[model samples]
Target: MARAHWHFPRTALAEHYLNVFDVGISSHLAFIAPRRKGKTAFILQDLAPAAQQQGYLCVYASLWGDPNAPHESIVQALEQAIDACASESKIKRMLSSKVRKAAISNEMLGRVEVEFANNPKSAGTRDLTRIDDLVTQLEKAAKDRTILLLIDEIQHLATSDDFSGLAHSLRTLLDRRQGRVKSIYTGSSRHYMHLLMSTQSSPFYHFANLHRFPDLGEDFCAFLQNKMASEYGVAVAMGSLVKAFGDLDHSPYWMQRLVERLVTEKCPLREAMNYTLELLDAAEGFEETAKTMKPVDRLVFLELADNGNPFSRALLSRIEAQTSNKGIPGTVQRALARLMEASLVSQIKKGEYHIEKPGLRRYLEKQVGSAPSR
Candidate 1:
């Protein structure tokens, strides 16, 4: 059987961002969006392709690809980009070196191959220096063409102390290159992305234009409905498809799963929607995660969910009463730390927090009756 494919048209938005770069509004940009929202897909499939067509050398990297050592991915991507611009003989020599281990695939370097490496340690100063040198080499090799770096999960650089030197080196690279080297940094965590771009102490602070990546809206919904009916011979109602999309917070990643269920299982739309919700809940580990939290932490989480101020005296008093604690400040502080460590909450700024998973709020509200308050 042939593979099914779906192409989402985001070329217009891609062009808009590139145009911002071309006009000198900013040579670097930071795109913010939640997980499973197709940020990576838009970058790899749409933006990179558009930039390449506009005579730019695009090198794509994902920091999350190697959670331990993201710089390795950056190094590999730059090396691949350098090879892409190398002479035919040089490319052949490079290919020859690796051919004995694995077959030489033409498509591997058709665009820069972004792959993760297994290095237990975080990137050191030396590794960052090497990446900086590789960027310089790629820029030189590209001649007059602009080198556009599309970095995904860029928040890791800011959140992880190990990548500080790399972040500085990258900022310096972009600073020196000016118009010649541009970057599009994408991250799923808005809180961490803000840490990268908003904190004055951060290396990338105010370094790039920040934009919230829009969701795959009505167009994507209609496309999925039509594509399933025409290509897969699956009949799914448009309203049900839209509802499924909404139920998953408009995530194309999950919507694709719904489409697969509809086509392969020949399930009814309602059944597929329920299955998708189950998959999402399971993926989030909703109930299991809640069980692990202490009562104080859960209460603090509820307060954040209800948009209540964690630092306010009234909220603190309420938390104190609920948890039977005397030291409200210390108790709340520890709860915040524990919640953040579990990835359930994110500190947007000093005295402010956001529930990392919005769906978790709904789940908790369902599981715990009414919202907790002062």
Candidate 2:
């Protein structure tokens, strides 16, 4: 039997962005969402396909695709997009190289692999220069239609000093070709995303219109219900599905896993929800992360988890009482810095922070003592 393709139609959202581009409001767009929220899948499956149908040359580059050097990934994706546009034969060759035969499955393609070219020992100025040239080539190749560049994990460029020059070059490219080249950038880290866009010293500051990528909403829940009933004869309650979705932080990736347990293992809804929560906890390594925190940092995390204001006098008093140390602003600042460094929390603004992981609050509540309501 052929493998089933499960997709949620986010093409309407994509079209809305394109319309934003059409209205001359903002040629560039940026999406900020937490990890495993299906941002990449939305780009690859829905947005890219929609753009293609509308005669836009869509190219996707993931900065983290090459951990050692991210510029290589950008260069490779642009080159592939150029190749696909150059000739029909070249596109066929590229597709053949990317798609492979499955061993024992009816699936025609195993997995599409995107291979990046080798980078030099130090990929600094040279790679950045090449990226600039590649963008120009892609623009030239896209004669009539616009070239849509979808960059994933774009926060990587802003986080590391090594890619600062590339960031500036990218900003220059987008600025120079505002009408011809439109780009959509997606990042999992709001903290880094803010650094990229909010800081005056950053290259991409105010480069694009920022939009919060929404979670899989009721439509996805309805899709899950219909898919379950039609495909596996499993009629799960809508509320149970919605609860599982909420428990998993509205991540479609984990929701699929919960549905899989219901279908394959015949697990009840409550048991599957508990199992999914276990999987989520294991994946986040919350317990291990808490073990690494210093006593004061852990206390600060608990305080923030309970929605206590970090800069409030009440919080300082609680911190001093719990840690038996003078709860000066300097002490709280240091603890907050450490928590942000551990990726457990993120500073949204001055003296304002949020837990990066949604499930982290529940995890901390179970491990540590609970606090007063927000």
| Tens-digit per-residue lDDT, 187-228, candidate 2 | 888888999988899998988899999888988999988988
Clashes found in each candidate (C-alpha, N, C closer than 3 A)? 0, 0
Model 1 stretches with alpha carbons more than 4 Å out: 1-4, 86-125, 299-303, 306-334, 369-374
Per-model TM-score on C-alpha atoms: 0.81, 0.86
State which candidate has the highest TM-score. 2
Give the Cα error of residue 270 in candidate 2, in Å. 1.5
Q: lDDT per residue, candidate 1, 1-374, as tens digits?
A: 22225767799999999899878888889889877787866776678768877888787777865667878878987887797676545533533343222212211312111222234466677887898889888878988788888888898886667678778888887788776788899987767788889999998998889998999888899998898888789887777778778878788867887887888898898888788877777776777776777767877888898898777798787777766565378888998999888778888777878887776766666677553332
Candidate 1 displacement at residue 18 in angstroms: 1.0
Give the runs in model 2 whose Cα sits over 4 Å from its true position: 1-4, 86-122, 369-374
Among residues 3 or more apart in sequence or in different chains, the pairs in candidate 2 whose N, CA or C atoms overlap within 3 Å are: none
